[model samples]
Structure formats: structure tokens, C-alpha cells
Target: MQPYKKLFTYWFAVIIYDLTVDFTKSYIKSFKLKEQMDGAARSGKQNIVEGSEGMQTSLKSAIKLTGVAKASFEELIGDLEDYLRQNNLKQFPKNNPKIEIFRQKAAVLIKKLSDFYKNESLVRNLSNLSYLEKYFNTSSVEEKVNLLLTLCHQETFLLNKQVLSLEEKHKTEGGLTEKLYKARVQHRGY
Candidate 1:
């Protein structure tokens, strides 16, 4: 599929990966923590691609891998939340004015992502992921993590939608085994 023609999971995972890298390099100093964050980022992105490719042969496998991607983001969210709390920073509520600002930026970032495939520069396209980096420049690390948490939650919610869609498709169209059974029946004239 062109530019990952599915839901936004892989694209959002790319954002998570870049944001985590920026956060790790700029704020966090622990190598172990960086490893965990980066691992989750990769898993979150890769699983979406893997699951999409598997859909041709196996819907069950695709649903399972999509769930894995969701799990990875959930892990990433926990890590971000822990970092915020342990650093003695305040976590913002959903109704916080600051969150609305960050949420709007996330919407802009998603629009930028749609233009990414046409961009010739890989570096430039990846730079789009760092749209939130400007806020991290002057803001407290706590604020930055809160913004990340907000974006992560949105992406996770959409992943849930993707999983549900896949499950419904499977229920309606069946899977490889069902196809094989039907083909066998047709050949046998049953």
C-alpha cells in the first residue's frame, strides 16, 4: 500500500518514536530508559506494518498484532506518566487549557504527516515528528511529558478502532481456513 494506506497507527508511532528520542536526548539522561522508550516506539510502529501485511493471509494474526501495537503505546504512556510523577511535576487534567493547545498541535502534526510521503528529504519528513519539540524548548519537562501523554492517548484510542474494524471484518468475511474450507467444498461439489 502507498504510504501505509491503513489507519494512522504506524504514522502516529513514528511521531512517538521521534518525540521519545527528542525527549531522551534533551531531558532524560538514563541510557536504560532511552532503550525502553525506543524499543516501544519501534514495536508500536513495526507491529502495525506487520499486521497489515499479514491481513491477506490471516485476519486473526493481524488483530493480534494490532493489539500488540496498542500494548506498546500503553507501555509508553505508563513510562511517560511515571517520569512526570517521579520528577515532582504535575500532570494536567483533560480539561486543562494547556492540554487543548497540545491537542491542537497534534492535529496539525497529523496533517503534516499526510504530506510526508511526498517529501523528498527523509530528514525533513522525520523533522515533522518534532513539531512538539518547540514546546519542549521553553516548557518544563513535566509539561512536555504531559503533551506526549495526550498524543499517546489519542493514538491508542484510534488503535482500538482499528482493532474493532478488523474483528468485524473477520466476523463477516472469515479467514484463511474458511476460504480453504469453502474452496474444498466447491471442488467436491458439496
Candidate 2:
């Protein structure tokens, strides 16, 4: 099984975490909300990593963990939405030009990071957070919240797709335990 670390979603989670940290530090004054937001962001990212690492041994576990990651991102979406509502900020609509542009840039950056990791030996170690950090730092609070919400939505969508695929594969092929049992039987000439 390919490591989850290789997935673009994993790096997206990292970027999400970085942006959340910056958002909370610069904009959120309530310590409790800040901690809760940060925790959710971290959980979203970490669960994906855990899910990927367990994929080889247990598809069921991976599916569950990935679901957890999706839930965490959903929680973040709520937080970002709440922040915008409470502050009387307008969220970017689905058809907004800025939303489309940001989505495109995010996709490009994720692909770049994926390629970098795929060829880590040839490329110098680099962080993709810089690209977003620049925008995050300069954007208004409303824009920041909107961008984060979009990211959360994207992450949850990806996670859901991943879970469905894993479930399908599990149904058709079974897990490591089944494979091991089959190998054992064959080895014993059953």
C-alpha cells in the first residue's frame, strides 16, 4: 500500500493547519475557541495520516479514520462559518470569481507539493505553506474565513471519495487478514 504521506490531501491538511494557526492567532481573541479550532484542524490532518498508515493491515480501520478526518474538517467548516456570521462578514458565494481563482491556485500548489514529495531526493526540502501564508497574511478576516471554509469543504469531499473507494476495494478483495489466511492455506497445500 502506498503511504498516506504521499497523498495530496495529507499536504492539504498541513496547509489547512498552518492557516488555521495563523487565523486564530491573529484574529481570534477567545482562548477557548482558538484551542478548539486548532484542535479540530490538527485532528483533521492527523487522522488522514493515521488512516493511510493503517491501510496495509486494515482497510476497515483506514475507512473509519478517514471518516473521522472528514468529520473534523466539517467541524472546522462550522467554526469558519460561525466566525463569519458572528462578525457580520459575507462568505464568498459558490459562483464567485475569487472562489474559482483560489481553488485553481490551491490545486496547483497541491500538485506541486505532491510532485516534490514524489521526488524528494531530487528536490530540495521545501514547504508549500509559504504560498498560502502570503495570501492568508494579507487577506481580510472575511476572506480568510471563506478560504478556510472552501478548503474544509474540499478536504471532506476528498475524504468521502477515499472512503467509498476503500470500501469498494475491501468488499471485492478483503483485507490483510484474509490475504494472510489464504497464503497460509496455500503454503500448507490445502
Question: What are the candidates' C-alpha RMSDs?
Answer: 2.5, 2.8
Clashes of each: 0, 0
Best TM-score among the predictions, by candidate number: 2
Q: Give one digit per residue, the lDDT tens place, for model 1 in 1-190.
A: 4545434676677777788778877877889998898788779888888898888789999999999999999999999988988888888999988888887776765666655645556436566645346643426677778877987898899899999999999999999999999999999999
TM-score of each: 0.87, 0.89
Give the 10-residue window scoring lowest on summed lDDT in candidate 1.
129-138
lDDT (Cα atoms) of all candidates against the true structure? 0.80, 0.82
Error of 2 at 168 (Å): 1.2
